[model samples]
Target: AVLGQRHEKNFRPIHYASKIITEAELNYTTTEKEMLAVVKVQLNELNELRDQAYENSLIYKEKTNRLHNSNIKDRVFNIGDRILLFNSRLKIFSGKLKSRWSGLFSISYVFPYGTVELSQPDEPSFKVNGHRLKHYFGGDRPKLVVPDLQTFPKDQ
Candidate 1:
């Protein structure tokens, strides 16, 4: 309407609405949304997996330990109180008083037993921590299988 009014350009009317928009606020909201999607969610999943692995490890370790304390050395461990472990690498795992898998992992239950069982994070089978497995037991236990320790990274 104002553009159509040419000629002498007679003054019209004046009006103003109270409003505000901050560039900083808009940018901040955008940044926060991105961070939540990329960082917070991923971190939460990783932490949960780690915690579950730790819990599973404790359970597996404790159960296997019962066999140790049961005074059934001939049935569980033929090599006396010690156990030998052979990791996926075929490396011999040796330990002083238990299954070799116990030494390699601070949390042993995180390793997958097979592709079927390993598919889900919640059902992770016992895997030797690989790192510390050598301290307590050998690389070969009765039926336990662990991932490749040399290539595997420490859990987050």
Candidate 2:
């Protein structure tokens, strides 16, 4: 009878230990599932934030473009007007004192959409974009005067 009582005590401890282990495993699985659900919710929120940031960037770019376009001044040109051509090639070389304008061209024709035909004294006329030309305010014609040497007294 004592042996049977000892066996019963051992069996009871083993059964209780297995029951405790099973409950611990169940709690661990439940916690893991809850953490996974939280991670999924956080991922969804991150995606939404990314989308909102992209939309805000697009809005900012559009507003900047509109402001820039509004600030641009319109230039008008007519036939027979004298203009100076902007020398874009000068930008390649470093020279702050050098002038970027290189022409006293006359506008032979003005076409739609900013195209212009420029004519020089002896050169053939060529078409150029109107944006490269600015009005020359110097004069209708340039003049040259030669000083007579006889007017000055000759030193002995």
Candidate 3:
């Protein structure tokens, strides 16, 4: 009877231990599922935020393009107009006082898309971009006047 009582005591603990282990396993699986659900929600939110940022960047670029285009001044050229050509080659040298304009060229022909044919006296005519040319306001050269000096009378 004592051996029978001891056996009953050991079996009772083993059964209770198995039940506790199954409960713990169930709790762990539920916690893992909750964690996985939270991670998925966070991932979805991150993707949405990234998409919103991309859209905002595209909008910003479009506004910037429009503002830049609005500020640009259109240059117009016509035939027989005198223009000064900008000397881009002189930009390499450091000379603050030196004038970058080199030509008093006359526009012989005006082409589409900002192309212009320039002509100068005793020089071959060449084509250049209209952007490099500016209207020359100095029309005809001014004549200089010299004052006559008074002569002193010599004594005899």
User: Candidate 1, residue 66: CA error in Å?
Assistant: 0.5
TM-score for each predicted model, relative to the true structure: 0.28, 0.67, 0.64
- List residue ranges in candidate 2 displaced over 4 A: 1-28, 140-156
- Clash totals in order: 21, 0, 0
Q: What's the lDDT for candidate 1?
A: 0.42
Candidate 1 Cα deviation (angstroms), residue 44:
0.6
Tell me the spans in candidate 3 whose CA falls farther than 4 Å from its real position: 1-28, 138-156
Q: Which ten residues in a row have the lowest lDDT in candidate 3?
A: 11-20
Error of 2 at 13 (Å): 39
Error at 14, model 1, angstroms:
47
**Best-first order by TM-score:** 2, 3, 1
- Summarize candidate 2's per-residue lDDT along 1-156 as a digit string, tens digits: 010113745632211111123454356664564454455556767999999999999999999999999999899999998899999999999998998988799999999999999999999999999989999988655444786767767899
The digit string of per-residue lDDT tens for model 1 on 1-156 reads: 011223576643322222343565355564464443455456767999999999999999999999888975322211123322344533354544643232222232333332111112255444332332323344543545696767667899
Q: lDDT of each model, Cα atoms only? A: 0.42, 0.77, 0.77
What's the lDDT of the predicted structure labeled candidate 2? 0.77
Positional deviation of 122 in candidate 1, in angstroms? 67
On lDDT, the leading prediction is 2
